[model samples]
Target: MSRDIRIVTEAQLREVVSLDLETVDVIEAAFRALAGGGVVMPPILSMAIEEAHGEVDVKTAYVPGFDGFAIKVSPGFFDNPKIGLPSLNGLMILFSATTGLVETVFLDNGYLTDIRTAAAGAVAARHLAPSDVAVAGVIGTGLQARLQMQAAHLVRPFDRCLVWGRDPARAASCAADIAAATGAQAEVMTCPASLCEQSQLVVTTTPATEPILTAEMLHGGLHVTAMGSDQGGKNELAPQALARADLYACDRVSQCETLGELRAARAAGLMPDTPPELGEIITGMATGRTHDAQITICDLTGTGVQDTAIATHVAARLGGAGTVIPV
Candidate 1:
């Protein structure tokens, strides 16, 4: 007896999936499931290729009720743009949860990761940001920066967007792109502090080894989602900033302590005690924003459960649209 496995290309996946409210809901459910327990997720297997200025990470998870699990291989080469190549690319393999057999191969080339990551930002904003967000700011001008703004807008509509980056030209370009795509007034800010002062919601998406956002920039009635410190040695916000937040949450407490901004805070003796995970807040196990004046921060260190959720979703949406091979 043989089984069939579907091969879905990046183009096919793009046609079925996008960074929209539907995808955000899918990721939100994954976080809820994570909080509900019975989800088995393993530590990420990561490697660094110093000579090439690149790193690769492999992650997977098995949800009890899900039909399949996904193993995603993601690579990020920061220097790729110098040669006109993309900075990130990868694929995901979905396998039957019960049978442990291959089910679908998604050659998404990191597209799914991008969508789910941006969706996670939206989830953070939906649950933590102030209800009446007039301005939103993003600290980096990369793909995630643009997508994070768009995704956040889906949940918390803002009147304007502030963009900041190391490269002024790129920041200006990103602002223009956001204005064109989101129909929101977008402008480039010279500094992160200035952006934070005016925006009610701020997202840090840079891979900066040094701190770009500091405690002094934190103000009342603000929510910050720091998603760039997914790897070790990457610190976007100063440790004091985390300590200053009225509420600090993590996508996964353990992962954030090791890879996200929490790592730096812990090392600096700032956040001595463990904070609640995002799943906890989403499932009502923990409290979210209680008052509009609360300063909230969420550390999103990408999780394997999210990959499993999005991959399963894409597989279903394909609905037998890909090439089938028997094994």
Candidate 2:
């Protein structure tokens, strides 16, 4: 194999990996691959800069049948908006599946990460949420919130949507974006309780150190996807909320213990030592949403498998071999 590498720019990657059912399936396949247990994935490498209100994470995974894998570098600087910069930016490097050659580089600036995260939320809803949904809700007015709503609509069409944020103006803007993106009537909710009450499918995407949605806020048959807590000490859903859920699942149990909704639940002694992984459900090794009246919670801490899957898929789309990157 040659040492030369292909560079896929953010714009090029966006055109290839659009937020649609196909891309969502790619993300789901990554989960299935994880559940199957042949992939080699290390614990995420993370660092925090408290002074800058920023954090960086490095993740990678190698699936047995895939031709290549990707190592993604994701940086989140929450304070960037103060200087008119986006909060998230990063890139991914794809390596050959054989002979350890460099394959392609995706300068996505975290766009692929955002897309896969939202798609994972939708996949969780598809396999767990009640068949019929009236209103879908999202808490937090960030990029993930809007993408979550858009992706959820791909699986289950909701009559309307409710978006909640601490800032009323931001919530309203997010609601408008959801309406435009998904063609669903979207409104801003002042409180998480009201949003939860009005929604059957809810996603929480806030980087709060303290809990936001409580068990009291959830009702029967509600499905919650919490995708914000990807770092230690970060939390969004209350421990009691996770404890009381009829079914609890995370992207990975190991990561959840250190940096997900389940972490808080375990710390408070509200949950068991092991919860089912979402991949298990997707692969049919475990059950998901057996009853319509069940309450389900999915805690996503992000995974390296996702980066590898999306990168491999994109690489093929942009001219890599169909089977695997040739050495």
Candidate 3:
């Protein structure tokens, strides 16, 4: 009998990063699949990720009714200078798609968390980014930043990429690394605001509490993906940026209103009453980009649908690699 099965560890995550070339495809496919219909996904619930100045804490629930585990690996604990550990640690407790029973568990928690997230970035680019988009701008230089940049390339090639990070040295170095990895000319931007000024497509992946992207910096026709504000109070987009968007889409409105970048805009009465859902847009129920010059924004709050999609994809790919032997 096929019992509850499958688990992936950290080493496997590293292996998949190198081994999986079709990762962005999986992500894009998932969105299309979601937009195509027939999948059921519950909302994700997460507590605030914060604490006293010296401490860090984050608790996230993958779905309502079905219990979930949020495993986060902290930063600043890396001993080695070159090969650092993942910032968020712990595996996801995946319940069965059919029965809501805890079927498979994965130990390579952050790695899976990341690629799926990056895939969402791919989804945003596919539906929103301009056909002529040739320059990609990314803020933040961490793992999430890397995945987003990589995923965007999978959707379409960029003539050049610009990066901005808190750490100048790391930013420049990471740009070089990405350039080498993707065959795209990449460099650290002289200023973070330059991202909005120069690039038509931009993504912000930082964990900033205050607004990092001001509307004053934005140019016309920029498609923005604000993915870092998965938790409440962690906002990356400024109100001006939201105001600048001609079309604003989100993974889910309920979650985005309560936590994501949409929260701030909603609080200020700047966001729309009926912003389109990403799924609806994908399904052709709604429009994505009506005009080429319209500014668009998509806020991602890490949903259970994406998690389950990744889990299912991983299981299919592994093909009994982690299946348990019968007793």
Question: Candidates' lDDT values, in order?
Answer: 0.95, 0.90, 0.71
- Which candidate leads the pack in TM-score? 1
Query: Residue by residue across 1-327, what tens digits does model 2's lDDT show?
Result: 234667778887766678899989999999999999888999999898999999899999999899998999999898999999998999999998787777787888998898989999988999989999889999999989999999999998998999999999999999999999999999998899999998999999998999999999988989999999987889999999988899999999999999898888888888975888999999889888899899999999989999999888888888642223333
lDDT of 3 at 94: 61
Error of 2 at 15 (Å): 1.7
Q: Which pairs, if any, clash in model 2?
A: none
Q: Which tens-of-lDDT digit does each residue in 1-327 have in candidate 3? A: 455455666676465443134766655555555555554554543333345122233323333322332333222223333456444555655655446565556677466778878888888888888777789999988877877888888776787899999899989887987787678899898787877788878889998889998888776678889999876778999977887878889887777887799898877788767688787787788899877688889998866556655665565556445645332
Clashes of 3: 4
State residue 213's C-alpha deviation in candidate 3, in Å.
Answer: 0.9
Question: Regarding TM-score, does 1 or 2 come out ahead?
Answer: 1
Q: Residue 212 error for model 3, in Å?
A: 1.1
Name the 10 consecutive residues with the lowest summed lDDT in model 3. 52-61
Q: How many residue pairs clash in each candidate?
A: 0, 0, 4
